[model samples]
Target: MVLEAAVLYVKPGLEKAYESAFQQASAIISSMKGYRSHELQRCLEVKGKYLLLVEWESLEDHTIGFRQSVEYQDWKQLLHHFYEPFPVVEHFEKVDLT
Candidate 1:
């Protein structure tokens, strides 16, 4: 599995709206190939900061498939504007657990 993580810094007072947007926009990615699941988490220390985690069967499903699809355009329209600055997305692979 591939884990995609992003740190979203929403503008102040836009947390609820952003979260709602995410809830709706999540469907776009969910419909794509190799999609597994996703989670959105709010930060306790930072009021409008959120953590977005998406699981995919492989990195190509996200980096190539999802990005090239029309659904990604809608995904950007729905949720990208809510962030103050664009979030940086990174991927990881599970190695081991203790």
Candidate 2:
């Protein structure tokens, strides 16, 4: 599985709207191919910071399958405007320790 992570810095005073928009946008991503699961976490210390984590079957599932699809446009329209400077998204693969 590939883990997609992003630190979202929402515009101040728009946290509630951002969250609401995220709620609406979740469906867009969840329906995509290779989507496993996702979570949105609000920072306790930071006022407008959030952590977004999504699990995909592979990098292509996100970078290509989702990003290239029509649903991505809706996702962007719903949530992209909430970001101030935009977030940096990164992907990770699990390492077995045992």
Candidate 3:
């Protein structure tokens, strides 16, 4: 499985709004092919920060399949504006796990 991680720094008081939007946006992504699961976590110690972890079957599933689809535009519209400076997303392959 491929893991996609993003650390979003929402603009101060927009954290609640961002979380609400993410809940709505997540549904769109979940319907895509090869999308396994995802979790949106808020940082308790660091306010306005969130960790988004998404699991995919392959890199192409996200890059080519989902990103290129029309739904992605809606996804961006819903979630992109909340970021202060735009989050950096990185993909990883599972290496060692219990």
Candidate 4:
């Protein structure tokens, strides 16, 4: 599985609003092809900070299948404006130690 990670820096006073918007946006991503799971974590020490992690079957599943889909637009509209400088998204694979 591919793991997509992003550190979201929300606009200061809009943190609560962003969380609420994320709730609606989550449904859009969960319904997409190759979607495994996703989580949004709020930082305890930092205000207006969050970490977003999403699991996909492959990199293409997110880079192409989801990003290029019509549903992504809805996802963007709902949550994109909350970011200040925009978050950078990256993907990774599991590093087995056993």
Candidate 5:
């Protein structure tokens, strides 16, 4: 599985609006190919910071499958404007610790 993560810094005073938009945008990503699950976490100390974590079957599932699809355009349109300075997304692979 691939873990896609990003730290979203929403513009001040738009936290509630951003959350609403993210909720609406969630459907766009959840319907994509190889999508497993996702979570949006709000920061406790920070006013306009959030953590977004998404699980995919593979890296290509997100980097190519989703990002290259029309759904991504909708996702962008719904949530992009709420960001103060675009977030940087990264992917991770689970490590065997046992």
Candidate 6:
């Protein structure tokens, strides 16, 4: 599995609106291929900061499969305007500890 993370800095005074938009946007992403699950976490200390985490079956399932799909455009249209400077997304894989 691959983990996708992003630190979203929403525009000031738009936190509630952003959350609402994200609720709508979530539907778009969850329906995509290889999508396992996702989360949106609000920061305790920061006023307009959120952490977004998404799980995919593979890297291509997200980077290419999701990002390249028509659904991505819907996702962007619903949630992209809420960011201040835009978030940088990164992917990770679990390390074996055994």
Best by TM-score: 2
lDDT of 3 by residue, 13-81 (tens): 988788889889989999999999999998999999899999999999999999999999999999898
What digit string (tens of lDDT, one per residue) describes model 4 on residues 1-98?
99999999999999889999999899999999999999999999999999999999999999999999999999999999999889999999999999
CA RMSD for every model?
Answer: 1.3, 0.4, 1.4, 0.6, 0.6, 0.5
Q: Which structure is stronger by lDDT: 1 or 5?
A: 5
TM-score of each prediction: 0.95, 0.99, 0.94, 0.98, 0.98, 0.98
Q: Per-residue lDDT of 28-79 in model 6, one digit per residue for the tens?
A: 8999899999999999999999999999999999999999999999888989
lDDT of 1: 0.93
Off by over 4 Å in 2: none
- Quote the RMSD, in angstroms, for model 6: 0.5
Indicate the worst ten consecutive residues by lDDT in candidate 4.
76-85
Q: Rate the local accuracy (lDDT) of all candidates.
A: 0.93, 0.98, 0.93, 0.96, 0.96, 0.95
Minimum summed lDDT over a 10-residue window in model 2 is located at 78-87
Cα-lDDT of candidate 6 = 0.95
Q: How many clashes in each structure?
A: 0, 0, 0, 0, 0, 0
The alpha-carbon lDDT assigned to residue 86 of candidate 1 equals: 90
What value of lDDT does candidate 2 attain over all alpha carbons?
Answer: 0.98
Off by over 4 Å in 3: 96-98
Candidate 6: minimum summed lDDT over ten consecutive residues — where?
A: 73-82
Model 3, global lDDT: 0.93
The better candidate by TM-score, 3 or 6, is 6
- The residue-level lDDT of candidate 1 at 5 comes to 99
lDDT of 5 at 2: 97
* lDDT digits (tens) for residues 1-98 of candidate 2: 99999999999999999999999999999999999999999999999999999999999999999999999999999999999889999999999999
lDDT of 4 at 62: 98
Residue 61, model 4: Cα distance from true site in angstroms: 0.5
Better of 1 and 4 by lDDT: 4
